[model samples]
Target: MSDVNVIPDMIADPSAFEDDAAFRLKAAQAAIRRECGWHVMPNTALSGVINTRGGSVIRLPARHVTSIESLTDRDGNKLAYAYDPETGLVESLSGGFPAGIAAIRYEIHAGYDDAPDVQSVLISAAKRAGMSPVGLVTSQSTNGSSASFDVVSLMQAEKDKLKPYRLGGLP
Candidate 1:
């Protein structure tokens, strides 16, 4: 993890009035607005993680997203989400998002807990579903573990492609 600066949420010193709560709040709001504005637009490309219920969007570098898939209960069974290298962001969603996504893992997850190992599961699932996993890379995250690809792109891509979906449940 990168060093997280823990600045006091609010400065109390009156001498710091020029740098006081109101100014800081405005600055913070402006910064958030800028990022939120970016989220409202799509970039050339993007990548992120979606949870088991098909919710939870985690934005990371595009290169970090390792897989994607369209899920199905074809066998009259609920399938577990898996990672697919070929079904990576640029290739898979470039045409359009898969009908059902089991899960999307970022390069950062490699070697962490259930992550890196899930890469193989993703590949198998994609094959079973008749999709291909490509552009897969063994890399590290900003934290420097055996990470996978998160999403990568200009601000616009995520805004357009990923933002509208609700988190924590099916669409």
Candidate 2:
């Protein structure tokens, strides 16, 4: 993932801002993931643990789950489960999972293989960051030229595009 460039070629000239672009892209990706509450890009064989709510159905802390490599109880006993790959909803076939903190362990592949909407958000953020002058100047003027930097943030429309990927019922 580190070697992959999420920023599109049409967004900026890679040759001129190679290092800066990489840095900004990374920052933007992190911000997006933080906002969305999960990794929006594909991650294979990722291990995760979640507490059970004492039900047959449990929601994994992810979206677009592709596969489940393993599912186990707190005692390391293998558990049978059925899951919806798109919703991350897992149902235990071996009765309900016990209620406890981090009682379920799972290894799964989840998220989009390629999310263009997410990429667009990243590009927008990176571009905003790249254009702003360093430090905290909201507005600057020199030699009859002036510039104003709007704080870099996801627009409402961008946030709307990410809604489906967000966790914890946040809008």
lDDT of candidates 1 onward, in order: 0.31, 0.73
Tens-digit per-residue lDDT, 140-170, candidate 1: 3343323443112223432333322212112
Model 2 agreement with the true structure over 1-171: per-residue lDDT tens digits: 343433333323323534367777777787788889888896556797888777899888887778788889888889888887655678889878878998988888877888888889989987887776762234444432444434356768878888877975532
| Cα TM-score per model | 0.20, 0.73
Candidate 2, residue 86: how far the Cα is off, in Å: 3.7
Error (Å) of candidate 1 at residue 152 is: 29
Off by over 4 Å in 1: 1-9, 20-49, 55-103, 107-171
Name the 10 consecutive residues with the lowest summed lDDT in model 1: 162-171
